[model samples]
Structure formats: structure tokens, C-alpha cells
Target: MLELRPNCECCDRDLPPQSAEARICTYECTFCASCAETVFAGVCPNCGGNFVPRPIRPENKLLKDPASTKRQLRSAPCGARTAA
Candidate 1:
């Protein structure tokens, strides 16, 4: 399952797993739409693949399994929010 990361890796914006601004690559490296579009040019820094909007984690589990709260990375937010 995706970590449903709480913040964008590039802008430190709250993602909350439901925000349309959240973007992710195949590896689920998270960023905000602004960063993904402007700073990254749709290419993930960690992975060269293009990004897509992150799917929202449901409020209630529809299946037996559920997502975990583990964070995969916490790199410094790239540059400034204005860049995003």
C-alpha cells in the first residue's frame, strides 16, 4: 500500500492523502502538483518516470488490509514555495 504521505516532498504542503495537488511516481515518491509540474517537469527526482496524482486512502478499509503510517523519505523541501 502507498504510505499516503502527509506532506509533499518538494513543498512541505499538507497532502492528507486526498488532496488533488499530490503527485507520485511509480515508486510512490510524493510531491505536490505545483512542484511536479514546475520544478520536476513531470519527472520524479528520485525516479525518472513521470508522475501521476496520488490516489486517496479511503476513510474506512474496504478490505482486510489497510495502509500504514510509515514515511519513506523526508528530504528538505526543494527551494521555496514560490518555485512551486
Candidate 2:
């Protein structure tokens, strides 16, 4: 299941469970669409992978499988480090 992280790792922007602006990599690294596109150019800095829009879990299903409240932030600002 997707962790549906609560915030963008790059800019620390709030991304609620249903936010259309949320983007994620295969590793589940989450970021806002702005960071994912403009800052990172659709590439995940942490995993060197492409990003895709995060799926929103249905409201009913969310009760059982809740969106993650744990927010993840990168140690450095967006684009601060080069992909390995």
C-alpha cells in the first residue's frame, strides 16, 4: 500500500491524502508537483527514479488504511544534491 506521505520532502509543503498535487516515486518518496516537476524535473533525487502522481485512497477505505501522518523531509533543500 502507498504510504501517502503527509508532506513534500523537498519543500515541506503539506500534501493531504487527497491532494492532486502530490507526486511519488517507486520508492514512495513524496513531493509536491511543483518540486517534482520544476525543481527535480520529474526525477526523484533520493532514488534516481521518475515520479508519478500519487493515488488517493477512497474515503471509506481510508478509515481502515489511513494515510500516513509521518512527514518526511530531505536533509537538504530541493536539488541541493546530485543524483547518484
Question: Considering every candidate listed, which one attains the maximal lDDT?
Answer: 2
lDDT of 1 by residue, 24-46 (tens): 89988888888888888999888
Lowest lDDT 10-residue stretch of candidate 1: 62-71
lDDT of 2 by residue, 20-69 (tens): 99999999999999889989999999999999999998899999999999
RMSD of 2: 4.7
The whole-model lDDT of each prediction reads 0.73, 0.88
Candidate 2 TM-score, C-alpha based: 0.90
Clashing pairs in 1: none
